[model samples]
Target: MLEIITSSALPVRHGFFTRKGGASSGVFAGLNCGTGSSDQTEIVAINRARVAEAMGVDAGALAAVHQVHSADVVTVVGPTADRPRADALVTAAPGVALSVLTADCQPVLLADPQARVIGAAHAGWRGALDGVLEATLDAMEAAGARRDRIRAVIGPSISQPAYEVGQEFFDAFLAEDRDNHRFFTHSPAGRYLFDLPSYGLHRLRSAGVGHAEWTGHCTYRDSERFFSYRRTTHAGEADYGRLISAIRL
Candidate 1:
């Protein structure tokens, strides 16, 4: 069975899928749906297909992008001929599922039931700091979504306790806004632990979203279910599995 987390208030069918029902084996175990990984193409396809079925949609209707870590948001009308390079996708059209793949980075799902628009974003620290959440909200607004009516839920992601960063990362955030220092805490090694989920919620609230929350599941700490890039790197693995999150009207 696939462990999918759904937001009750969103008024849409969506899930933050865990690494449960999948075809991939070995280190790339569970539902490793990333085609970009070294995992066999056939296995990745199979995993994605299972996810599509679980979402009650055709595999082709489950659209995602290349996700180049930019603030780009694409509007999905129907299945695109190709998955463009974007960090977020929004749609007013029902039956077309918009998805974002992540390991420790935030997978944010946005929906405004009244406006009948939904969106998904792949928000890492870089993308979040660069305004991907705000960009996603803007795209949803363009597709007839009202910010005040939108409920945004952030899926499983790396929490600050597990996310130790160097001085440069802290400096970069401080350079953006001195008040950003509130999102970081000094660690024993003199590094900073960053609160990515809190930053995400702050951005959503700042964008005027009616509701925003993080599911509070730390990917790095839960190795049995979630596939964390940081954990993989810490364990010296070649690559890590990407967890998929999707939303539909």
Candidate 2:
């Protein structure tokens, strides 16, 4: 069976799928839905099919983007033959599921049930810093969703304890805003432990979302249930799986 995490805050049908119930094996095992990975194309299709079924949509109705860690947001009305180079998707159309692939990056799902609009975003630190979450909110509002009625939930991602950063990384955040220093703390190894989820929540709240929260699941800490890019690098693995998170109107 698939292990899908959900939040009561969102009135729409949505889930943050874990790395389970897949046909893949080896490094890209367990629901590796990233087509960009070296995982077999057929296996990735099968895994995505399973997710689409779970979301009550045909496999082709499940829409995604070619994520490039930018703040770009696409307003999707239907599935397209070509995946746009974007980091987030929003839709008011029923039966169309917006999804994002992540391994330790924030998989953020947002919805305005009253407006029947939903969005999904892949927010790594770079994307988050570049205003991807805000851009998602903007796109949803453009699709007729209200900022004050939107509720957002961030799925499993690398927690601060597992996300150590060098001085340059810390410097970049400070360059954006000195208040960003609150998102980091000194680590025992003399590096900085960046609080990515907390930063995500801060961005959503600052953008005027009605509600925003993190699921409190750490991808890097739970290897069995999640695929963590940092963990894969730490283990010197050739590649890693990608977890899929989706939301539907």
Candidate 3:
């Protein structure tokens, strides 16, 4: 009953899970898998368990990190006591699911089935600019994945039409690289709209990955199907749910 979005480019078992078919209620309604949220811990666990089931892995085999939004990537050797404070995970181990939690931020899944390597990452603007995507590729290569065979698919994210940012945000990107200007456009409100997915794809492609794509589902625009941090803030909600995406080798 879970709404899972997948891409044909990745031969491995992976899914970009939607905020549907979950046990949460109130503001964190429908599949809030983030344990750091105000939602009940047991409920979040149940949601994650469902994801693990969908990925055909044990609950403990679904590995994730604390997600500090940096370029950090962790290579999953096996189950660990502490979730390393990182935003990405890679694994060559079969039966282990690399998962990332996101709300509007990009949930990127990468796979190179021939090399038996897979990776999942949580990429926000800061994380993307900091090279999280490239870092993930590096970690996967370290785990035996071949860059040319790896396909990266970006899941639900806030599209440019819905992502209005101030001049400062625009300036931040420009400061990083002048080419970053191409990812922004002037909105009707005299602000800038950033193309998050395009930027993500750009990063992935620039890193020399064989293929990169976006699901084209805008998280902020699809309330019933996704969890959007910006949407929740726009509605003045107390808290927002987090969506989960996973990949297994």
Candidate 4:
């Protein structure tokens, strides 16, 4: 059984799928659905098929954008004949699942059950700082969702304890807003530890979201259960798996 975390507040069908119940092996083990990865294309298709089945939708109904770490949010009505290049996706259509892939970076899901609008975002440091979360909310609102009725949930991501940053990286966030310092702490190695999930929640709350929470799973801290880009780099691996999170009305 796949250990899919769900939010009770979300009225629609959604899941923050973990790296379980997959046929992959080696470095791409356990539900590596990233078609962009070096993982065998057949394996990725099979993994995505499993996710589609879990959502009670056909594989073609699972819509995902070509994420490029930007604030761009595309409003998808159904599986497009051509995939668009965007980091976030929003839709009010039923039966179409909005999916996002991530490893360590935050996979943020948003839903306004009352308005029947759903959104999924692939927010890394660059995208988050560029306003991907806020962009998603904006797209949802454009689809007739109310900010006061939307609930946001952030899935497995690199936690501050496992995320070490250099002075330059820290300075970039500081330059954006001095208050961003609250999301970082000094590491023993003199590097800075940044809390990505907390930052996501902060943005969500500041956007006047009805509710926001993080699942509190660290991608880097657990090797058997998740794929982490940083962890793969630390181990000198050629590539890493990408986790998928999806939601549909």
lDDT over C-alpha atoms for residue 56 of model 2: 97
Count clashing residue pairs in model 1: 0
Q: Write the per-residue lDDT of candidate 3 for residues 138-224, one digit (tens) a residue.
A: 999988889988899999999999999999899999998999999998899788999999999999998999999999999999999
What is the Cα-based TM-score of model 2? 0.99
> Candidate 4: where are CA atoms >4 Å away?
none
Task: Score candidate 1 by lDDT.
Answer: 0.93
Q: Give the TM-score of candidate 4.
A: 0.98
Q: For each candidate, what TM-score against the reference?
A: 0.98, 0.99, 0.98, 0.98
Residue pairs that clash (backbone atoms under 3 angstroms), model 2:
none
What's the distance in Å from true for residue 195, model 4?
0.6
Q: What lDDT, from 0 to 1, does candidate 2 have?
A: 0.95
* Tens digit per residue, CA lDDT, model 4, 1-249: 677888886778999898899878889989999999999999999999999999999999999989899999999987754568999999999999999999999998899989999999999999999999999999999999999999999999999999999999899999999999999999998889999999999889998999999988999999988889999999999999999999999
Query: Clash totals for all models, in order?
Result: 0, 0, 0, 0
- Scored by CA lDDT, what does every candidate get? 0.93, 0.95, 0.93, 0.92
Q: Which ten residues in a row have the lowest lDDT in candidate 2?
A: 74-83
